[model samples]
Target: MDQFTNFTRKVSANLTPFAEKVGTNFSQLRQIATEKMSNSAIITELPREYVETENRFEPVKHIHADLVRLARKYALDEGNVDFNKLQNQFIEITSSIGEKITNLASQNPQQQNTQNQTQNAYKPLNVTIQHQLASACISNSEIVGASLYKFGSTYEKIGDFRVKMNHDILENCINLLQGEFTSNIELAQKSRKDVQGARLALDALKSSLKGASSSKQAATAIEIEKAEEVFIIAVQDSMKHMKFVLGSPIIIESLRNFAAAQLEYFKESQSLLETLVTELEEIKLTQDALYYSEVDHH
Candidate 1:
């Protein structure tokens, strides 16, 4: 028992620095994911409607819905104005805002183009669909990354339990390495979910566009299809965040480096642990005479 205790202490002293270095490497992986993988340019690649106002022909824009309430509040704060004159001026200002609200409400437009332009303000979201998809991709990527982090945290807890069970630094290190490997697998699972989440939102947005009666909305239907392509591409690109990324030659090399580190750590630690175990077993067998003498003396 004494042999095991002292051996574990020695192993802990050796492994603590390695654990710190692994932690630093993990931080670097996250930074790389944030810095190298995040692509905001995709947002700008979307349709103009996302970045600017749609070219709809509704005559009024940014109408103050509380204009009347504001005017009434102003009147209450001030000394009494002539009621008749205030009423005339209020009507004129409201009339200037919209023909429908004014005395000209009964008059129809003479031109067909003018008549056609005065339709309902039901603007569909076709123009900005691409940008919305891009935003969704970004949001889901963050969600998947967050999920992966949580998986790692959970695995770390399991590692703690394993270390407690064994009371060996070698066990602790091996458990932690196993936990990381499991969490890496979970990252891929969560990424698939991220893709599904983005797809569901995009489908819902497309459904909402179906109610619009504008000619532009028809054009937008076509535009949304293009946006869907971008969404898929963006999602594919987001997988670069994985520490154990797999794909092209450059990515595979990166994955290999991380894998190699983990494997090397495990190999070296296991080798050291086996050596200690063998030494302890030999001491336990050969030191029996001394051990019994000390026990008898005590």
Candidate 2:
């Protein structure tokens, strides 16, 4: 009985910090998103903030810049939607995870990590066509040749071609984020339900420990120890969920997608530009040959 008491207290201690951290993580993320949502959209348009308009229309680190411009403007400002119907996505996802943490604190531990099959897991609800391209898989890959550098030739087109390539990449990234936003929000809802089920099982052990007798208490403690082991397995999952609450995975994926999109443009532009230079070289050779033949005849 004494052993059970000590073990129960230990489990309680572990759960307290986990529960509190879960709350803090969710609140921190939701707060950051709320604070930045409106201003970020405006900042994305400003020169050199999220995008550079002069030399190259390149995006800066602010990946969610377009969401600031398009979603907030159309959905919140002009669309006339209510808060309940259209809550901010980050806030919504955090809220969903927060509820899961609350339920899990009382419930049984899970046998498997849900993070293995979370929203972006499995087949990927948001498929990135760019990631399929070679450039996306291989970052910063480019082709160079001596013919590309000839005076007033293919080298001149490089600057404009790169800019256009980046433009397409940024555009695709923006669209991808927009699409995944809703899907993740929905996943949060579903994850909450799955966690709730785990919570239900977890509650049984807690109840067993609540008013256990000398005989039953030992069994109860053992059951708790079993549940604790599960919690231990799922702790890594919790941390992943915490990061998901903070919107890191989506942002990281977007950056990768940008690189992938750029790769495609690099390949296609090199092909077309190299072909043009080759044709130009052939035409120059023909002209020289004709001139030399006329000179010989004279």
Candidate 3:
């Protein structure tokens, strides 16, 4: 009998906290329903400091979201061409060139040198319509002559610069902005939710105070004071979190990095293209003079 009594005491001890929690939850639910039905429950006004902090946070949140979106779009901005598809096509075309050369060399073993030259000569023209024309131009210029090859090489450098610029934007700007949103903004939001829950709990306890019997009124009032303290602390914590995010310089720094990367890319591309244009003009004049000389001779 003593053992059974001890066992029963242990079970009750284990269940006591759970029972209390369930009871508190039920009371809160009942209070919520009563207030919803009658609208007689007094709504507690938040402190002015908390209200001001919340107002300040609103614009920061809006701007942060907008910055994140703009950064992502800038990182991925490929005008009309599908960059991934073009890269894949370039890979496929280059890989096939090696395979075709190997097959031709094997099929005409005695005449491998002649066949290799002929096959390589025909390869560039074959890929012009199906692949990136700039890449095809590079292959063709390599076989035909040196002047066109230099122009194709400059064009290739521009393509490479664009790819590097996008990568830098994604790595340094977009990713940094996203990290701020996740680490700072989301944490502040969670703190705000905690403040709301603490406020609700304090409000629920205050509502219960009016119905307390004379014997329980003193203790109930004390509980209400403790709940009020908890709510105040929650508000302060939330305010601190929100302020940290608002005051952070990461957003501005990321934007600056993004702009700097773009500026460098454009500057380099413009320099290369301008030089190429001058060279092409000189080549065009020389070709024109040669054509006139041949016409006069005929």
Q: Which candidate has the highest TM-score of all?
A: 3
What range of 10 consecutive residues in model 2 has the weakest lDDT sum? 42-51
Q: Is candidate 1 or candidate 3 better by lDDT?
A: 3
Q: Poorest 10 consecutive residues of model 1 by lDDT?
A: 56-65
Per-residue error (Å), model 3, residue 176:
2.5
Candidates 1 and 3 compared by TM-score, better number: 3
- Model 2 accuracy (lDDT, Cα): 0.45
Model 2 Cα lDDT, one tens digit per residue, 174-238: 55575755455445445444433333334445644566888898887886677555544443343
Provide the RMSD of all predictions against the true structure, rounded to 1 decimal.
43.9, 26.4, 7.9
Q: lDDT tens digits, residues 78-144, model 1?
A: 3233323443433433344354334335555334224323532331221122223333443344355
Each candidate structure's TM-score, on Cα atoms with residue i matched to residue i, is 0.23, 0.27, 0.66
The lDDT for every candidate, in the order shown, is: 0.41, 0.45, 0.71
Cα shift from native, residue 297, model 3 (Å): 9.5
lDDT string, candidate 3, 1-298, tens digits:
9999999999999999999888767766666676688768756678898889899988888887888787666555534324344344345444665665467557753364455457557643222221244455655764655566557657656655665566677667777877856588889999998786677677777787887788988998898899889888998999999989888887788889889889988998899889989988888898889989999999
Deviation in Å, model 2, residue 116 alpha carbon: 55
